[model samples]
Target chain A: MTPRRSERSGPTMHDVARSAGVSQATVSLVLNDVEGSRVSAETRARVLAAVAQLGYRVNSAAKSLREGHSRLLGFIGDNVASTPFAGEIIEGAQDRAWADGHLMLIVNTGGDRDLEERGIDSLLSRQVDGIVYAAMYHRRLKVPAALREVPTVVLNAETEDGSLPAVVPDEYAGGRAATRHLIDHGHERIAFININTLESGLPAVVERERGFVDAIEDAGLKLDRTLVKRGDGDAETAYRHAARLLDRKRRPTAIFCANDRTAWGAYQAAADLGLRIPDDVSVIGFDNQTLIAAHLRPGLTTMALPFAEMGRRGVARLLAGGSGAGVDAVECPLVERGSVGDR
Target chain B: MTPRRSERSGPTMHDVARSAGVSQATVSLVLNDVEGSRVSAETRARVLAAVAQLGYRVNSAAKSLREGHSRLLGFIGDNVASTPFAGEIIEGAQDRAWADGHLMLIVNTGGDRDLEERGIDSLLSRQVDGIVYAAMYHRRLKVPAALREVPTVVLNAETEDGSLPAVVPDEYAGGRAATRHLIDHGHERIAFININTLESGLPAVVERERGFVDAIEDAGLKLDRTLVKRGDGDAETAYRHAARLLDRKRRPTAIFCANDRTAWGAYQAAADLGLRIPDDVSVIGFDNQTLIAAHLRPGLTTMALPFAEMGRRGVARLLAGGSGAGVDAVECPLVERGSVGDR
Candidate 1:
């Protein structure tokens, strides 16, 4: 009998009850807390001791299924396969979620309708408390209809009609601050270079471009059409655009890049044209991507998008049930480096 | 009858069955796939049509509890919360996992015992099929004992005792290749600068140092201890360490950095001392970190560790149910840039 007992695996509720001299129902009541029937403290302690000694384990999956909520939150990124920016957002969201006793279930949607819809369905089926839809940029988005029923927050992007609650940087302020910084340093004849995207619509891009133009107008500087170029949101495009600007008879004293990558392209074009930074043509960029800005020859002077902060606050808002109708914006600050100098 | 129907708000299986003209049992059979019960193609099609029309949803939590395994894989990254390198690894792992019909559950342990243990426990509770533990670097590791029961593969970190499986870059080969590149260019004297971490045991460092020493020893050249410096794995530390090396009476004709970041530090130190890259002294580094290397005055010539490939393969190995007890060393290739020049 002893040898057979040793050969048997870990004990279950039945074994615990039998050893404790109680009914299995009582043990179940004590473990599951059946409100109607209560067990004595002595009996409960004995059952617990037997269970501990026998190494009884509760099946978490069974418990979760019964509880209806899995204590899991999901994050669906539009396209994390291309950019490192979304990674910071994930880190921020994960950190906050982990601290609150929840695990983050993440999926990269690859911007596919089927994949995005499937991801939302899976997260919902898993009974996630909330879902976070994060995009690489603030694009006018057409969210999957399935997710409309679930509690979701859009990060770094806004709703098409501004109905969904979203969190994004105050790009207009960031642009204004960068231009102001350049203007205060006694530089005029500034040009704005940007990428043409639906997200970079006449609204977002124009907001930044307008901020730059406004600063120039306010400073009483002449605004020239030849200086304002569209980079198509890429390095090669920005490089060509910057090359065209620099090759013209009268180059603008300064150029404001839409983003850091484009600014890097402008820097390369400037370098290729034998113009020195600050001395030949001052360059300013947005988004202080540390990896790029730090290593650039003179380093890039740009604004730092509050990616981590936005992610952190976005998670906080989602957890606090801050879902209603409308979008929220955050402000990004300018980071001064060597790329901008006095005229 | 129509007015009475208003009292019943929730959907029922009969409604779905009626909508598709299928029997309740057939609908259940198609939707739940009750084991051993096969439904005809016509019945399955009808059930699916009914489901789509009525927006029928299955309770995945209950199903997963019954099935004992969720279509989810867990990845525990070593401090992904603070670094970008881990981001690349995660993106690679997630993309591969997504293609294989599995969702990735990411847990950032932040290099803590309790957190690491909780991360694994959370995965187990979710009933994930396998886990991938990705560390930031290849070095000795202390994997939690509780994880031995679950199938797991380590990435970017090798086993302390080689018995555990790991996938890391071939550092020895990388070191030899870097030294050979410098040597082939007719550099007689060379120096190696590295970072100091407890996990980076003498064996791995010695392997690289041996490669550098061997390249010099084979050529009957003197290996100066004064030129060999350790950066302690940071820009400030590497800056100071390289500064000391440059201050020496007899400096090596060229210096090899242990990693790209450390190399960036060395490059800064060289610039501060007015030593032109490849003109006064040639410099080479390992780990082609694009953010750091691409922006250097002379782009860094270094080896690109196959982190993405390792990530892809690590997930694949876990999904294939391979025992986590083997080593898979990936090759690191050299990326030519302006940092290293022919002496």
Candidate 2:
């Protein structure tokens, strides 16, 4: 273990005392703000001035030990620090935590069970005021048993048994909203390129598909099961599926893709078939990943995942003594760009 | 301010002592592992078993106060947690810190000076072993004066006056490699779509452009000033520029884009003009952002910015008592996908 370097370089209380021509004990009293220090006002001012000149800072570790509060929150996530889609989650949680005068100790465990246990142990050892256990995506998970020792809230995910407060994106509502937008655009024969659910069985895949079906039926349009193709939520897979659908003689007027990457594939498929977006074939997507959606030839219209809002709400819930056992679903707003068109 | 909740719920030392049939003082002595304590080996084993059964963790705050080491590293960044391109940087730093039995306390200030100062103050008060001050993109910056009080290293950026150690990407080499790859493929007339340097004057723009010019000169090929067009590093701007170039009577066979986004624009321009990528026009880019580069129809061939490596080296430098005032440039590896084709 490396010895702490602060002791070697940081100015000590003795340095402040010498600069102020005061006793070390008196300097400590002034710096620590001891309630009943008897130092004169002028001497206290001089000591503070010396401390500032020397750039001396109070050691919060000692203060936390005395107050029984570290004023630090621990954030443990499987891949929040590494995944491109979840950086906003950390940003929101950090912003809110800072607003409350607390800092976050973050650990990205990469979904390793042993690392997760170690991360929890580290956070517990530090005496963090609370823990925000987050997932990179919306899923059901069993939180570590150790998290029960502190105020914990799940973010972007839910506890398996629904025994913990969680903040997740309103996938069903988002799906419904996405389909409704297409219907609103007068796209009757819409093809839904759904994400594959055979392997992951993600809640997002099921809820969004359900919303697509409900919206089509509500609009009095006959559901064409053949038009719905399963993709792996990737560009290549979606591209192949999109090509097959668009190549048909009688194809849907619009395609509702599972996500932005899928939308990208559909865009390529349209290009290959000499179809202009929103003019020849309208396209919509979920998870408005700005990198792809905003930059596409015709910007993709999609549902924005409320990742940042979910993160902020997660921290807020943890700070508010944690809410009752249930999931708090945040709304995923529709971001309109150039892709959606009137059919 | 909200009080810390650990005191209300966490198991106490008294609880451990009661469970082990030992005194509170004895439990503290055993848990703290005080040097030369008189506790018998049998009693120590019993106390350890009870601690394990009750999941009683040692309070690191108290331990830090006693040992003068918090075993924590502070990571301060402008937009790391919010930007898509920089998540891997955080992952690298956090992984290294954790491997050394340390946790990272992260604060993303969103480039607010006031927030930056407060973040440094918070880390100082918490007695972090060291700090890694980072920028979202590679640039020259003046680190906060408060950072002088601790061991600090800059990541993905350099100090304006070269007064601190830093790790930045080798932009020049990456640019050279990108241009050389095209030249090697027997492309003589290559148009360079460079990022606009007048606005941001980013080092990456200047360095990458220099590398492009050097490679052209080194290969004994005349540098065509007319082939270089300035772009705002966005897809729209690149599209307009690429369209004009590709529409010319005698246009360059290959286009070297400053970055992946710029390349994305070039791709669109080619598609609109009825030109196939690498078939009608060979294209290359820099900063292989996986979101764009990997998902492009023909995966984009580009030089990847060594972001994660820079982050890892930054923490490693800070841990090794920091280095002399200079910048350590890490290599940007070339990632070959399907965008580039034989000329």
* All DockQ scores: 0.28, 0.58
Give per-residue CA lDDT, model 1, range B103-172, as digits (tens): 7889987788888888887787666777889987676687887566556788988667665567787777
Interface RMSD of 2: 2.0
How do the residues A1-343 of candidate 2 rate in per-residue lDDT, one tens digit apiece? 4547545557878888999999999998897788977989999999999988988777788777767788899999898645786678888998999889889999999999999999999998998888999899789999989888788999988888999999998888888889899889888889989888635768789888988899889889899999988998899999999999999999889999989999999999998898889998999999988988989978899999988888899888888877588889999999999999898
Q: Which of the numbered candidates is closest to the native, going by highest DockQ?
A: 2
Q: Tell me the spans in candidate 2 whose CA falls farther than 4 Å from its real position.
A: A1-54, A198-200, B1-47, B198-200
Instruction: List CA RMSD, all candidates.
Output: 6.3, 3.3
Task: Give the DockQ-based CAPRI class for model 1.
Answer: acceptable
TM-score of 1: 0.79
**Top of the candidates by lDDT:** 2
Candidate 2 has what TM-score?
0.92
Tens digits of lDDT, candidate 1, A58-84 = 555566655555667889987774565
